[model samples]
Target: MKKTESISFQDFMNESYKKVKRRSRPYRTFSFVPFSPFAMLDPTILTIGGIVLGVVLIERFLERLGVLDIVDKISSVMRFLFPLTFFGAIIYFLVTF
Candidate 1:
């Protein structure tokens, strides 16, 4: 009769997994200002626009998961609303200031 040895899950994984090698190059940091034509936009308008964008994104995700429908109509509205709201915010800020 022959005896067999069983390997534990942790031991099997350790043996099968390969460690990634670290890069030898030194890290460098760079800084630059992002182009923001809306930098002067009103805070309130920006906040509202952000909220709308967030809702649209969440709804789209739900639609993908089959948890919700009506995204087609919502997306159509959002297509027009998104740029309008944000750009309106910037315009309003510029005009008011």
Candidate 2:
């Protein structure tokens, strides 16, 4: 049988550290969006909804100020209709209550 060489503690630690560094994977980042009404809902869906709402509001504001021109009439109409429908639903709910 061949005699095995023993590794010094410092050398063993360095080798282990190097192996760990080589095997390390990149960390993943996640965005958190806080929605009070939907606390029980999935965080990913909440984040996506918040992002979409922010984009829609920004685009509508820019369009209103003539800073952004939307080429699609259907998109423009849908944007306008969404807010109106939302407010109308709120009013209807309030009136029913």
Candidate 3:
């Protein structure tokens, strides 16, 4: 086995300070989201976010166009489902495990 050089405590600390990460672009941050990739990323979360985004965009567009008063019906359904979704997901996880 090859012998490795041991770093002094002071040398290790100095080396850590010297190493800098250069950012190629500005960081994107979202509220209530963590800076970690693994913490922020989950396939289920991504799918849910995408679905919500599309729904909101479509609703807004339809509202602006004054296509119909369909949003009221959707809002009613949302009010009922919102709470159920939160509680149901927790129950689903519990049952799955």
Identify the leading candidate in terms of lDDT.
1
- Residues 1-97, model 3: lDDT tens digits: 9987776799787796456798799888777742455643556655666776677687778878886678777667767876776576556544543
Which candidate should be chosen as best, given TM-score against the real structure?
1
Per-candidate TM equals 0.46, 0.31, 0.45
lDDT of 2 by residue, 1-97 (tens): 9987677799887785344435668998765642344443545445655765876787777678776456255467768876776666556544543
Instruction: Show pairs that collide, candidate 3.
Output: none
Cα displacement (Å) at residue 30, model 2:
35
Q: Which residues of candidate 1, in runs, are more than 4 Å off?
A: 1-42
Q: Write the number of the candidate with greater lDDT, choosing between 1 and 2.
A: 1
RMSD of 1: 19.8
Q: Runs in model 3 with CA error above 4 Å?
A: 1-37, 86-97
lDDT by residue (29-89, candidate 1, tens digit) is: 7757543566646577668877997978888797988865577777777889888887887
Model 1 TM-score on a 0 to 1 scale: 0.46
- Which sequence of candidate numbers ranks them by lDDT, best first? 1, 3, 2
Give the lowest summed-lDDT range of ten residues in model 1: 33-42
